[model samples]
Target: MVTRALIESVLTRARERSRLLTDSVDDGDLVAQHSPLMSPLVWDLAHIGNQEELWLVRDVGGREPVRVDIDALYDAFEHPRSTRPQLPLMDPAQARAYVRTVREKVWDVLDGHPLAGSPLAENGFAFGMIAQHEQQHDETMLATHQLRSGDAVLVAPETPDLGGTPEIDTEVVVPGGEFVMGTSVEPWALDNERPAHAVDVPSFGIDTFPVTNERYLAFMDDGGYERRELWSERGWSHRREAELAAPQFWEWDGKSWWRRRFGTMEPVRLREPVVHVSYFEAEAFARWAGKRLPTESEWEKAARWDPRSGRSRRYPWGDEDPDDTRANLGQRHLGPAVAGAYPAGASGLGVHQLIGDVWEWTSSDFLPYPGFSAFPYREYSDVFFGGDYKVLRGGSFGTDAVACRGTFRNWDHPIRRQIFSGFRCARDVQGEQA
Candidate 1:
């Protein structure tokens, strides 16, 4: 399955995503600090190259590093995001030239190497890893652009009006049963998602779509933010300390809501899944609505459940890879499509937008599965396994196809509201059926 074509396709995706990250902004914007939480765009530009060089060239191909002298400069672990700006980052052109130089050699490596000898190269995992890494940075860089001011530097055709969207809130019933929770077959699946295991989950009812902006706005309108009882002690304190009136980038103009998007201030899109909300916010909203965030297993079963086959799917819609018509991914459009937009992409139990829209927050704290082992490096997923972070399932609009899968797991600090995170509620059925 790890054909040369597949390897080249992954490389092309990485190149395309990198171009998208670097081409939109001027050199000044590349180094400018958009947020202390994010690295400079130029930093990401070179870091992507650095990762490729370390893995594809030095590690896999058994070649000397093209830029060993600058390796430490781009080591993400060495420089925290807050201090990255102060480091001696290469200029955008230098970074671009360096990556291009690295990539040219990487292609040569891909052309002649034996991809079967190692796990990293087997199944084109290393190429896919590099592609996924670059695409992830592309998402981060898009976040930077969203955080930056002045004027809208990015543009995408508005999300389609997928007309027959479900209205009047309803939940679908997922019968209690045993199901495969993660994956062992997916070639590019990350380590945390490894060693697929069986999970016995009770029957539950889950929202047909992600919690929409309109529904969340209703929570805010009804004093969801003011009521401490609805929030956890930590959540309430964080909300109070930060004074989160609404999701990040939102402003209630007293009359109605107005918010900033890529740089344009406009009314919030009502039907899209609420994005940039913290775990606390999601939990608070769930409390106000008298529901709960689904456990990681519950979320996966809902999205991947298949009655006929009694198995988990690779995506909400069965196993064929994502296409633009099927899912809104690969930064094809910046903002999420309207909720209930992709009927074809819904799961068998009628869950919509489960694949690409927003990273749905789950109730579970991130922990490793049974027989879990880190491959290549521990820094990727091993470092974040704890209560300090909450898991988010599904992928966002900015997520690329190569990086996302039904079992793909994303995690972040509970107080973070800057990333594209959202949630859908799940409730136990009154008379559960096993």
Candidate 2:
């Protein structure tokens, strides 16, 4: 199904998104580091171009290198985010010109190359990979905009409201059994999501909707942060060490809580799923609610498995791609739609907001699936396979559809709160108190 036209369109769309995010701010802002957690926006711009050139122009097309001298400068592994601003990164004008030149060459490679034979080119996998890569950075850049300190620089239409909260059930039972966990047929699936396999997940009760701001506020009012008993040993330690109080960007006014969204201050919408909570924070909140974070498998089952059909879907709503009606994705809205807003996007078992809103943290660590193998490069996924990273399923509002899906996996350090992340709670079906 991956045709030359489709590949071109995907790549074009990715570039447009990348440009929109970068062009929103001035060159000075682009070159400055908004957070130690992320690289300067200019670094990301050139890095995106460098990766495209490395993978497509050189590796796939066997074309001559473009600006081989600057490769080291943009090599992400060579420079950490904290040190990136100190490095001699490309100026905005130079970075823009460099990427433009590289893209022109890439277009020639794409038009001349056949989309077959090798695994990288077969079904246009490499092109799709590059598109996904750019989109991932686009999401990262959007997060940088959120972290930036200044006036609001970016804007998007508000997410659709379901008028009022829908009268939906609060929880749903995934009568789980064996389900296919990963993908073998998805043309663009990355190494971590490859080699489809079966996983037997026990039945569990998962929240019908993600934990909303209203619900999380209840936890805060009840002293969720102060109660050490609700947190794991390490989580409790991190909570105290970081002096964690509220979710990142949240501030308590004299009357109510307000949050900074992309440099704009607004009252925290009680109906929206709370974003920017760390994995530790999500864990603590789940414990306080008398529930537990679902394991990676449980989250996937709740989002993808249809018990009646004994089949797994490509997304929560089915095999179709995401749209405005399905989920709050592609930065279509600056924030999550009100919880229970996307009724049509609910999973087979009636779990709502499972696909997008915020990246939902799971109890599982980032680990390889059964019969996993590194493809093309080990640095992509193999390097981070361990307990230090917790698996986060589903994509956030800032996530692009090209880089997200039912099996798509995201991971981060347990204490990372800068990334847009939230959680839904689950409990075992058998005699587990909730």
Tens digits of per-residue lDDT, candidate 2, 292-363, equal 999999999888897678899999889999988788888888998888788889888888888889999999
**Which pairs, if any, clash in model 1?**
none
| Each candidate structure's count of clashing pairs | 0, 0
- For each candidate, the alpha-carbon lDDT, in order, equals 0.88, 0.90
TM-score of 1: 0.98
CA lDDT of 228 in candidate 1? 92
Please give the lDDT score at residue 128 for candidate 2: 94
- lDDT winner: 2
Residues 30-110, candidate 1: write the lDDT tens digits: 999989999999999999999999999999888988889888999988889999999988999899999999999898998
Which parts of model 2 have CA positions greater than 4 angstroms off?
Answer: 167-169, 431-434
